[model samples]
Target chain A: MTEATHSAPAPSPSGFRLDRSSWAWVGVAPFLLFAVLFLIAPTFFLIIGAFQDADGHFTFRNISNLFQPSIIASYWISIQISAASAITGAIIGFFMAYAVVLGGLPRWLRPTLMTFSGVASNFAGLPLAFAFLATLGRTGLVTVFLVKWFDFNPYAHGFNLLSFWGLTITYLYFQIPLMVLILTPALDGLKKEWREASSILGASPWQYWRYVALPILWPSLLGTTLLLFANSFGAIATAYGLTGSSLNIVTILLYAQIRGDVLHDQNLGYALALGMILITGLSNGGYIWLRARSERWLR
Target chain B: MKTSKIGPWIAFTLGALYFIIPLIATFEFSLRLKRGEYSFEAYRIVLGDPRFQATFGYSTLLALATIVIGVLLVVPTAYWIQLRLPKLRPVVEFITLLPLVIPAIVLVFGYLKMYNSSSLLPLTSSPWSTNLLLTFGYVTLALPYMYRAVDTGLRAIDVRTLTEAAESLGAKWPTILFKVILPNVRSALLSGAFLTFAIVIGEFTMAALLDRPAFGPYLQLIGANRAYEPSALAIIAFFVTWACMGLIQVFGRGARGASPETR
Candidate 1:
């Protein structure tokens, strides 16, 4: 291909400048069209609609209407779920990666865990909810088995598989794996020489981690945690499948608003979606910023 | 070192238990269809049901269409960006990643209102257009993975040199892109296609909202109605996802991060 372009000097650079300049963009026109028509146009319509009144005139009514009790509670619950799941997933996944990379384990374990994480991370949404239901639901296998074996019921201890905590556990199925998938590479970026150098300087293991490893890893750790936060915040199918309309997280609430205008106001639904976009966008933006900062040192 | 080894073993065991127990429970629950005896009756019933066949077939076809559309759109754009329009790479990348930041339900919400019957374009007025809209939605959802894979593939081969070589041979732009560029990125495209297939096959929100007959909604419907079939369906879904991931691992091996040339 390179040779062909070099050899094809039929159209001299000075003669074809006008045509070349215009032709260059033609290659990307289809991509731009698709993005505008599908992605940007739809989101733009919603953002504009969020400020419009029922009669399609500009107004602040919808934005103000987002301060309602039900709507606020929905956002609160969504934040809690995202925070809880992201923190748990980050901690456990970091430890898991740490174990494999620094734990003096077998060589094959890293690839094995990585492959499993790939599957598990994508193994989310509806089937994941069902899997957790089968394992932890009221009449689920482990629930029944626990009753039979230990004469104790998990439900009796307020461990319903469709509540706030239950949803967090379900979200962790994908969240933890995603964390492991991302953090493994970051963890691998940790140099063995740094660890050895720290220990040779009479630094204890805890002191070494606190000084050298933790300082280098905090950016990736925090950035990935923010990413996990946004991931769970946008997720709906698992929660919807597990709890139905019983749990009023923001995603499911927006879903209800979309399906039936359960909010009784069309424009409020637009505002709801706009709010969701803002929250998730902020987290992702933060993730990218932190990653760029951390990668500077790693590079 | 002593505590580090012990810590990893404990973490590995717990992680394995957390990940594996769900599959075991689902499979075990799927078998208790005879009230007292373990059997494959649930799987039999699910496989026999016409609704299952219809929804699964519909989703499979939708997934195939999504893959084709994704490839047709992504391959050329990625190649062009890497070869010609390097300045637009950041803009293209940001747009591709937008779908991830914007939730599927919310994006579909934007679609429902913007293209509804009363809207300007009214994409949902006809069933075929609604299907087209849903396909576009899948493309948007799958854009991140597809673009990343193709871009990575483009980086692996010498894009500018390949384009120049193909041009020097008197080949047209289409031939250069399709014949020369596409084959070099075959494995990456396959990896992306498999990931997109897994995503589209069991997707519930878009299909349900669009009123399409898809496997995801069917599974949810069965879960709401039946007891055991849902678990059976879950197992099947897990199996399909596992196969897709396995294929991705197979095709994507050694093609990620640093290019083969660099290695």
Candidate 2:
């Protein structure tokens, strides 16, 4: 597809050559204008605002203010939850994808899993939070069933569906499905010949995974884990809907700051957004770079 | 082989249980709003509520507008890139992926700052303009998926040959684009539109922070106060998302079957 597009024949020498080139650009002008006004400009404004003080003088104070204990704690908690969910989601989703793709399962299950993953991955935000709450809240169906059938209550066992762990669990609902969706293709990239050759050469399954499969899959695995981390790190709605103001995740803190200027510094909110962009940006950059690396082998 | 299949069955079973149990639980809880028996009382109240009607209707309209605007903006650029300036593909794709790198909250924060009432553009100066800004924000959010879908669609068809064929027939640019190129990618456009609908319907951050009375904020509001209605809303939202994905699959399959090149 790319080759066909790139290989468009150059127009024969004619007076209309210049006109045609310019007109082609005109076709994309409206899209470029919309992107500038809405996407690029607003983000650049915040990036610039993050460096400016109230008086419009440039200062590093906003960035420095991020180190304050409460702010640091919020970022730390956000990172922890994101990391926890990403790692757990990666592991569980890998197993599930493996089960569907390579576990000798029925052929019908692949499309079913893919379609479910599509729905589940997009089935996020406030409604996702509500779903988890209805499933695990104090009077939830699962909670009541556990009490009645198993003689135990998660709440009595010190499990609350409104804490750091609670938030991680909720995040995994989407994270796992996203992992399954992305990693399935990478798993498909693993040629069966390599596994068959390894097995015929008397390598054990564990050895094949450790020596060959793991090395081949490492970049995608780690890169996707980073992607998942970024995915949850920047999310606010689910955490906000699940825990409200009780949990001090960075996103919730920024939400509060955005709503009421709780930090008493508008620039600091820009700084908060800057901090989020930097983290998600770096992880996504890593994901893209490692994806390029993996593509070399996969292709 | 039997042992290997057992492991897969267990994994598949656990995954299915994890995914499905929540829906079952939410549905059960939604039905329990009337106290004694399973009933659609929560769905009834939620469906009948004026606020629910208003917010859901508002979001549906916004989602439709976002789809139309997104399609209008994406299709031309993608087609132009594929047909004319293939060199700009990387730059355009990078820009589309920017939203994923930057969170929606951060993007909306940027919009709030850049287009505030005091700003020169003053997009938020009026309800109409603010809604416009909100719609644009959604277009930005959905840009990545929309562009990828349309670009893939454009690629599947023989864009160069189709363009030349239409040109030889004396079809102008607009006619060639609309009549010749678009119908070839109808399924792709529908798939992208439905995905955008799923995304914008219950979106929380942009709608909430923008102070729009869309369904996302409505869901958050109800979740904060009401109990069972939120569950009912979640069920409904899930169905909407399911419908969108199902339609995409349906249209996507149709396109594959219709286009010999796709196979």
What is each candidate's DockQ, to 2 decimals? 0.60, 0.60
Question: Which of the numbered candidates is closest to the native, going by highest lDDT?
Answer: 2
Tens digit of lDDT per residue, candidate 2, span A1-299?
22222222343323335556655566677888888999899989999999999999999999999999999999999999999999999999999999999999999999999999999999999999999999999989899999999999999989999998899989999999999999998999989899889989998889989999989898999999999999999999899899998999999999999899999999999999999999999999999999988887787
Model 1 stretches with alpha carbons more than 4 Å out: A1-18, B1-4, B254-263
- Would candidate 1 be rated incorrect, acceptable, medium or high by CAPRI criteria? medium
Error of 2 at B263 (Å): 9.7
lDDT of 2 at A280: 95
Q: Residue-wise lDDT of candidate 2 within B1-263, one digit each (tens)? A: 32368888898899899899999999998999887898999999999999999999999999999999998889878988897789889989999999899999999999999999998999888989999999999999999999988988888999999988887776666776778888998998998999999999999999888888999999999999998999999999999999999999998999989875441
Q: What local distance difference test score does each model get?
A: 0.88, 0.90
Q: After superposition, how far is residue A189 of candidate 1 from its true place, in Å?
A: 0.5
